[model samples]
Target: MNLQDSAIVQQFQQHCSLTEEEKVLLLELEQNPLKVNAGDIIWQENSKVDQFCTISQGWAYSFRNLGDGSRQILKVYLPGDIIGMRDFAFSNRLAGVAMIEEGIVSHFSHEHLLKIFRHSTALTAGLFAIACRQQAVLTERLIYLARRTAQQRLAHFLYEMYLRLGRIGAADEGRFRLPLSQEQLGDILGLSAVHVSRTFTAFREDGLVLRDRHRVTLPDPEALAQLAEFDGGYLNDAVPALFFDREWQSHMLAGPTARSDEQMPGKSKAASAD
Candidate 1:
């Protein structure tokens, strides 16, 4: 997929008002989107950071290596998700993000990004919104880890993925590929690997979901929602709490060139929104 045509970049434009000059600069960077394979480390924890990366296809996860030699999966980033935006402050990597499947990513220098913000209020606000959204995701995840049960945690994770996949038009009406392993799942959900497997087996037996290796099918949507206590309130596009600015919203829906209804089910689309 061409990075320039990726929905994430389009969303970024809407969120961070890109001027013609900034667009031109991004176009140059987008022309050479990087391809990465599963298991490849995109960045290492504590590594010096220079470029910001936005996921265009497939999925990635960020994690920290614990002193006990265990890795904790912190966040899963899908298409349209940008990582390391927080590191723009310190300009250094504090953790690592690795691809979970084959994917495309675009990287931009920190200096150029700062330049865009320096010259444009709209761009600055858009970037701020993106930062806020990331913070929101992180906060919600923290709450899930601290307060939710194992079953509820798993359910909530699935529901979040479902909504995100639907947004990018990459999901089957209620199902999609799960690009994670049992161990990775355990890390993200704060459960043991064995516990993750057992919980998944229970989900399968209950007929709420079906799983085979890296694929997951949500067979009963309502049941799954109830299990997760998913109100969809956390994903409200119209909610100002997610950090969308009015100007960015206006620019996105202002023209036909704005967001398009993503094609779904069996059609191959770039993984930007997931």
Candidate 2:
């Protein structure tokens, strides 16, 4: 089977159709897979941030080691996830990324992204939409950590994972593999190992979640969402329809790009108050 036209591109641009040349730009990011084992560090914190990567096989995550000798996991990388995006603008990595399972990573230079941005406005829009959606996820994470109970946090995290996996067909009907351990969960959830274990057990007993080792099955995802007070709306993108010129359908025309207002934010305020 060919690697081009893979699900990774489809996930990134669910709302727009890519021209043939645009598809090539997207596929360029998926080239050159390097096999890595579990616990492998793709890149360390403070390393030079000049690349973008895609997980073509398994799972990975970005995390930070706290000064107090603990870890704080920032995001779980699924198969179709574009890693290194969080640091696209930075000269050095703010956090370290590592593998959660043996997987293949397609690593490409940050310049490849520049090519996409210069070549395809539709792709740029898709990428921005994804970034905004991810920002929403991070915002929800904040709310859960600050206001939710331990059980609520656990349920919300698991259900969120279920929905994410379902998008890539790795999960279905609430059945999915969570390749993470209790200790890892603790890092992601801002809880101690024992607290995560206790909360996991409590939710299990309450029939909010069921697990067989690493495999989790949500017997009633609706009920689980209810218990967590979770909102799945953030996962969906609301990008507006993008249009391309008939003469330049495959890519954006080459020229000086539009400049942002120097006054920017304040200028928008000058335009409208309602």
Candidate 3:
């Protein structure tokens, strides 16, 4: 696969209209690619963090081990995701990343990324928008684990994956290949493997999804979305036009000081209405 034509770049292009010159500059920043096999650790918690990578193909996940020795999956990384961007402000990796399937990732030094930031306003804005979307996904996962029922969490998770994969042109007719095991799903959704299996059975019995090993088919996306109480607003693809406004740009440059309080899943206005 062409690294330049990867889904991550396509997604970035959607948010920022890059000039030919800018595209060349961005391409130069990426070094040789690395091949990761299934179960390989891409980065480990507390490791030195000097570079970020873009997933050119396959899937991976970021997770952390709790004090009790159980793992909490932070987020699932689909093809085209920028891994390690979430920990840009930190000196070391805050979480561990591991490949779920054979994949390719291209690394870009943090120094080179900073150089790009200094020279390109549009690219910087695009990167910021991508970071915000990553944060949104994490927020949604927090909500899923804390307040949503097992069924709701599973439904919402699958629906989100479907939309994400669709954005990358990886899914068709609501069908996609997800290589995660039941144990991994349990880590992500805070359930036991047995519970995850039972939930999958429930979803299948309800006619929401059809499962064939690693392949999943959502027969009725609309019905599934309703069941999950999913709102796609959190997955907005375009950056706000107002971000280009001078005053707004200045405000963003000043940086955010405080983060929003964690949101309860069913407490949001949209969720309450459902």
Candidate 4:
């Protein structure tokens, strides 16, 4: 697939305006691809984090291997995702990454990324926006795992995947290719393999899903979304700028000393709703 047309590139454009030069930089970053096989461990946890890679083809996932020989799947990757950014501030990998299926990846050095960060503010902000979206997904996962019911969790996950895959036109009319196994789904949702199977049966009987091998087609996406209690608002793709002014400058100068309590970022954001 062309790097210019990849999901990450399109997503970056959604978050910020990109110059043709910046677009070329993105293309250059994904050059010199290496082919990988399904089940290949791309990198082990605790490995040096001096480099990151973009998924040029196929699918992959990051996971933590628990002491009991089980796994907790952290993030699923589709084509165009640049891996290793989560560990950019660290010297070692935070989680192990593996190929879910045969794919290709292009490795780039941290030094090169730093150069891009310095040279392109637009791209840098775009990257930051993308990272925030990833963080939001993890935060939502934490919430659902702690509070949502099994069916709710499963519903939410499927719906989320549908939306994400839809970005690249991989999903339409509620149908999409799910490259994950029942065991992998269990790991992601903290369920047993049997539980995943049973839940799939329940979903089918309830008219929530229609499965044909690895492809799932939601019969009634709206109804399924209601059952999932899914708030897709967070998935909205935009990174509008906050135009600071003299009042904001005064707040920066005085809020720290005069009214420190108002200086919280979340508080400022909420105040902007006015």
Candidate 5:
């Protein structure tokens, strides 16, 4: 399968059609496959970012390392996610990005990307819209950390992940691979490691979710959204019509697999904490 076969790339094309030359350019850009192992550093803070990358498989994260030996995860990059799209205009990076598991990524030089944009209006606008959406997601995450309760934050986080995964064909109903540790979750939520552990316990006790090794399954996504006071509408683009149009809905549903109606979280009464 090609990069265009991926759901996100498909979404981009549907929103704004790419020309034949642009498609050829993208294919050339993705000619080489880059691999990074778990725990390997991809890029460091303040480094000059010369390339843009798209995750072809597995997970990675962008984070800022605090002086106190802690890291704040800013965003999780999943398959079909592009990094450096938002930061390419800037000369310096404020955070580091790394792979969370063994993964393959596609890369292109930033200057070449700029050139493509200069030549293709459709590509530029679609990319800009995607980047702006990512910025909004990050900004909302900051608001959650600053103002929401631990339980609420965790619930919102899980719901958001499920929704995103569903978009990219990674989730079936409420269940999906989490691919991050509690410590990492803590970092993302601005909580201490211990607090993350305890909050997770409480969430389970209240019948929210079950966290297994690198997997989280939600039994009741609707209830979870209610608990978190989350509205899935925010996860959509700023375009109001996109939020409710059947075409966009069909796009989200156009995946290789169908979400099971008999959905249950992987959580069981005897489930062990990872």
Candidate 6:
């Protein structure tokens, strides 16, 4: 797909419709896209922070390293997510990001972002809203790590990924490509690799999920959500109406239409806000 017509653009449009001039400004901000190989470090910890990028394809993650030299996976980035938004307030990166698979990212320099902020209230507000949502995801992950049980944590994580990937048309029928290895899953979920393996066995025995190597299928989403106590409300909150087009309200509940054949099954054809 054309870079401008990609899922990230559709996601931005859903947040706030751009005027013709604003759209042109966005086009100008799109630098030549970067191709990232699997396991490549896209952003290094403590690096100078001068630009951000959108995940035009594939998956990546942010992680921090402790004094003990152990790594903690912070958050996962899917297609359409704006990477590095969390560092906008800082002069240097707080965490490093690495690609989980070969992917493309579109860069926007800090100067270009400032230009949009000064000239387009609607676009600025939309970007701010997206940043807020990203923060919410972090907060929820912290909560899950601190309070949820192992089973609950894994369940919640899977359900959350389903919803997030579905928003970008990367998931369908409760099935999606999960490129993380058992070791990586353990890193993110605070489990040992053995524990991750055991948890998968338990989930399979319960018939909650079907796994075929890197592909995952949630056969009974409602049951799994119930187990996780997952509430998708945080992911679906409406952007404030003032910064959006008149049509924004209608699209708010519908979300960005799927740009690929993948879609969430067992829901309405339109992406459900709930």
Q: lDDT value for candidate 3?
A: 0.80
lDDT, candidates in the order shown:
0.74, 0.81, 0.80, 0.82, 0.75, 0.81
In angstroms, the error of model 1 at 247 is: 7.7
**lDDT, model 5, position 206:** 81
Better of 4 and 5 by TM-score: 4
User: What does each candidate score in C-alpha RMSD?
Assistant: 10.1, 5.0, 8.2, 5.4, 13.4, 9.9
Instruction: Name the regions of candidate 4 deviating beyond 4 angstroms.
Output: 1-3, 241-274
What TM-score would each prediction reach against the true structure?
0.81, 0.87, 0.85, 0.86, 0.82, 0.85
lDDT winner among the candidates?
4
| Model 6 misplaced regions, further than 4 Å | 1-4, 245-274
Worst 10 residues of 1 by lDDT: 265-274
Clashes of each: 4, 0, 0, 0, 0, 0
Which tens-of-lDDT digit does each residue in 158-179 have in candidate 1?
8788877877777886778887
lDDT of 5 by residue, 1-274 (tens): 5656754466565455565566665566556678879977778889987787878778899999999998899899987678767667788887888999998887778777778677665566667767777887887887788899999998899899898889788899688988788899999888888998999899889888887887787889989999888866657634433222333323334542657642322322222221
lDDT ranking from best to worst?
4, 2, 6, 3, 5, 1
**Candidate 6 residue lDDT tens string, 87-200:** 889999999999999998888888888998988767887888777788888888888899988888889999999988787777898999889998888889987888988898
Model 2 CA lDDT for position 168: 81
Deviation from native of the Cα of residue 175 in model 6, angstroms: 1.0
Kindly provide the TM-score of model 6 when superposed on the true structure, using C-alpha atoms.
0.85
Which candidate ranks first by TM-score, i.e. highest? Answer: 2
TM-score, prediction 1: 0.81
Winner of 1 and 4 under lDDT: 4
Candidate 2: which pairs clash?
A: none
Candidate 6 residue 80 Cα shift, in angstroms, is: 1.6
